[model samples]
Target: MLLVEDEDSLREILREFFENRGYEVIAVRSGEEALEVISNKKFQIGLFDLKLPGMDGIELARRARENDPDMLVLIMTGYPSEESVKKAAESGVYDYIVKPFRLEELEKIIEQVTKEWRMSRENRRLRKKLADLEGEIW
Candidate 1:
């Protein structure tokens, strides 16, 4: 898991919280750091605060998707403008939570996305097996 927030306090809190929940978190301060980590590592899920210092969360998500299109990404923001929310929503972000978000709710979103990822991975494997079997049959 990757957590990106410009606020040090918030980033630490989220990192600790997710860690306590058994997630290996790579928490960072800016979207620049987030992008670097995303490009280098394969995290199951990424949580980004919308207004980072160097790059906004939306753009970070875009770049992350470019690196790994199946990665699950969640966006959080204290300042949720209509345009930003709409834009992020359109980009297939996993979920959005406003600041002061409840830990329980965040857990639920994580669980939901994890479940979906598992199913998608299983489906992909099955499809590949089917294709390979068909090729062998011919």
Candidate 2:
């Protein structure tokens, strides 16, 4: 997973929290750093803060999806607005999480998103297999 948050303490805390749970977390302080890091690696999920110092979360989400279309992105914000929500939706964020969220809640959301992504991938694979069989029969 890729965790992006600007605040030093929060970043460290989240990194520890996820790592303790056996998640391989690559935490970064800014979207620019995330982009650089992601350029070399891929993550199954991304936890991004919306109000980043440079290249906000929405843009990062977009680029992340471009790198890994099946990646699940969750946006976190201390300050939420209609525009940001709309932008996040447009960026294909999997979910929006408010600041001061419970760790358990975030964990649940992560599980749900990953489960859905896996199901969708499986469905796509099945569809492709059926198509191939139909072509062979025809």
Cα-based TM-score, every candidate: 0.94, 0.94
Candidate 2 structure quality by residue, lDDT tens digits, 1-138: 899999999999999998998889999999999999989997889999998997999999999999889889999999999999999999999899999999999988988887898898899899999999999999
TM-score between model 2 and native: 0.94
Best by lDDT: 2
Worst 10 residues of 2 by lDDT: 109-118
Q: Write the per-residue lDDT of candidate 1 for residues 1-138, one digit (tens) a residue.
A: 889889999889889998998889999998888887887788778899999897899889888888888888999998888898888988778788898789899888888988898898899999999999999999
Clashing pairs in 1: none
Candidate 2 wrongly placed segments (more than 4 Å) = none
